[model samples]
Each structure stands twice: as structure tokens, then as C-alpha cells.
Target: MRLLYSIVMLVLTFSASADISGRVVRVLDGDTVEILQASRERTRIRLAGIDAPEKNQPFGQRSRQFLTRLVAQRHVRISGDERDRYGRILGTVWLDGEDINAVMVRNGLAWAYRYRGKATEPQYAEPEAGARAVKSGLWADPAPVEPGLWRKMQKTPE
Candidate 1:
């Protein structure tokens, strides 16, 4: 039974790791984009390992604009892992070998979003630390709230 369980897990993992390539039709925000696939199907993708400000949050527009400039109408390679709760593919976006997720964190346009009790990407930490140390982009704010916390605060009646 243990062997069977391990085999099942391996199969599931492999099945979820899809290699998708497409042109970015839209930059929904700093950490989300719409890709038009080679098959001519469009899919929304949420960038993995990072979260940018919500549209209504501070620096949100800047984050979106920055992402647009980086990827809009550009062909990208997506190393997808899973579908998010919202049905958006969760993946690392690459453009000419550049990891867009890491770039966002390095530029301080997005946070390295690692949930407690979840596996964290070691590659994400250094860029975030460097950005924070230098007070770049959104980090320039003395008290920048994370996008998750900012969303919670918005939901809680002021």
C-alpha cells in the first residue's frame, strides 16, 4: 500500500507539471496574465511565488503597468504546476529565460508569497531581501502592507 501511494503521488505530480508556451495577450496585474496558447485558446495564469498589490491598493497601478511593459504582447514560456482555486493556472512565467516572478520581487513590485506550512522557494528569498534592504519600489513605503493583509483590511469595515 505504501508503494502504491508513492506511485500515485508521483504520477499526480508529473500530470500537473505542464509546459505551456503562449503569447501574453494581457497583463491583468503584476502577478497575473492572460496567455493565448498555440492552439488559439486563451487562459488566465496567476504567477506563482509572488503576489502584487490589488488594483485598489497602493502602488497597484504601478505594479500593473510595470508588468504590462515587461510582458504585454510578448511570447512567454510557462512552467505550470496547478490550477488555482479561481481556475487560473499557477506557474512561473519566463520570457527569454528571465523569471518574471523573481523579477517582480527583486524590483519590489510584488511580495514573495510563501504561505506558512507550505514549501517556499529559496530562490525567492534573496531578491525580496535585497529589495527590502534597499527600499526599492513599494518597499520605499515605511509600512507597506502585504497584498493578502491589505485585502483582509479592505474587507474588514473601517
Candidate 2:
């Protein structure tokens, strides 16, 4: 059993390290999106720059819908960065010359995520501030929970 577990761990570790790309076919929410890459391969990408409230939260759907409006199933360019503990790609998605990550923060859909990675570019910081100032997304709440955390909470058994 232990040997089988080791093999599974190795496979999962290698799988997580493999880099691939696909067109963002769907935006699941503020932090999760579905991609249809070459050969009909499908993947879910978490935008690296920002994090938004969970779908169950007040502005969760709004943030997700906002992302859809910004860019939905667009032909995008994806590259891997440092993987978070969740093994989600910390990649920058681009549609034309615009950075989708930056756009999310600017439009009040997400908050700049600077925890796992280093501080983002100053220009990147601008959008988050603007969005927060306008009370967009969770910024409007007196105390809003992050979408990732909300997901964890929902899964916990009473």
C-alpha cells in the first residue's frame, strides 16, 4: 500500500509540474476558469494577480460575470509561474496586449494577490486600488471572505 501511495504521489507531483495551455473557454468564478487547449484538452486556471470572493459570497457571481464580460473563451497566451500550494498555475493571461489579471483588479472584480508571490508591478497595483475605492466586489462589504476560503468552509463538515 505504501509503495502504491508513493507512485501516486510521484505521478501527481509530475502532473502538477507539466505546463500546458488552452483557450479560456469558461470562467467558473473569480479564481477558477476552464480552458480548452490544443487537442481538446481542458484545464482550469486560477488567475495569478488577484483573488475574488467565492461564488457563494455576495459579489462572487458578479466578479465571475465581470471576468466573463472582460474576456470569455478568448484566444489567450498562458505561461507558468511559481505554483501555489494548490498546484494552480500562476500564469498571466493575455488577450491582445491587455493583461486579464490586471483588468480584473482594475474593474473591481478581484483583489491583488501578493501573498505567495512578490509584490506586483506598480501599474498592476493601480487597478486594485481603483476598484477598492469604488467599492467594487468585496471592497463594498464591511467584512468579505475570499472565495478560496469560502470554498474550504463549505466543504468542512459540521
Best by lDDT: 1
Q: How many clashing pairs per prediction, in order?
A: 0, 2
C-alpha lDDT values of all predictions: 0.90, 0.75
Local lDDT at 119 for model 2: 41
Q: Model 2: residues >4 Å from true position, as ranges?
A: 1-21, 116-123, 148-158
Q: lDDT by residue for model 2 over 56-123, one digit each (tens)? A: 77888998898888668677776555666776667777778787888877877777766554445456
Runs in model 1 deviating more than 4 A are 1-15, 117-119, 156-158
What 10-residue stretch in candidate 1 is worst by lDDT?
114-123
Top of the candidates by TM-score: 1
Clashing pairs in 1: none
Determine the backbone clash count of candidate 2. 2
Worst 10 residues of 2 by lDDT: 114-123
Instruction: Give TM-scores for every candidate, taking all chains together and pairing residue i with residue i.
Output: 0.87, 0.70
